[model samples]
Target: MKTAISIPDDLFVTAENTAKKLGIPRSQLFAKALEEFIQNHSKEKITEKLNEVYSNDTTKKDNSLSDVSVAILRNSLKNESW
Candidate 1:
């Protein structure tokens, strides 16, 4: 895919140099950066959805159940040779 975009001159030079140093074309560098940007934005969207769901939940946690789980975890860890 071919696309045109504008960026600062210093950044452009830096990207060009970095791409040359890494032996990859400037287009690949931009593509990789754009791909990372999309991935990061997708993660942000997922986090936002999770936060929304948690905020709307009304479940109360049982202290005894949590304590038992923690105790079991501690017991399991104690027997491990580290």
Candidate 2:
């Protein structure tokens, strides 16, 4: 597929330089950049969903759980040098 878009001359030059330096065709550079941009954007969406899932107070840690965890950590680390 072919598509056309416009960008500033300086940015275009930079992209061309980067593609040449990396030994890839301009199309491959653009495609790789777009793929990374899309992946990062999708990660943001996944993080938002996780935040929503953990937003409730019921998802928060309580004192008993913390106490148990601290006791276990202390027991495991007592014989080890700090």
Please name the candidate that would achieve the greatest TM-score relative to the true structure. Answer: 2
Instruction: Please list all clashing residue pairs in model 2, or write none if there are none.
Output: none
Write one digit per residue (lDDT tens) for candidate 2, span 1-82: 7889898999899999999999999989889999999999999999999999788676346767888999999999999996
Look at candidate 1 and give me any clashing residue pairs.
Answer: none
lDDT of each model, Cα atoms only?
0.92, 0.91
lDDT string for model 1 (1-82, tens) is: 8888999999999999999999999999999998999999999999999999888745445667788899999998997988
lDDT of 2 at 69: 93
List the lowest-lDDT window of 10 residues for candidate 1: 56-65
Alpha-carbon RMSD, each predicted model: 10.1, 8.7
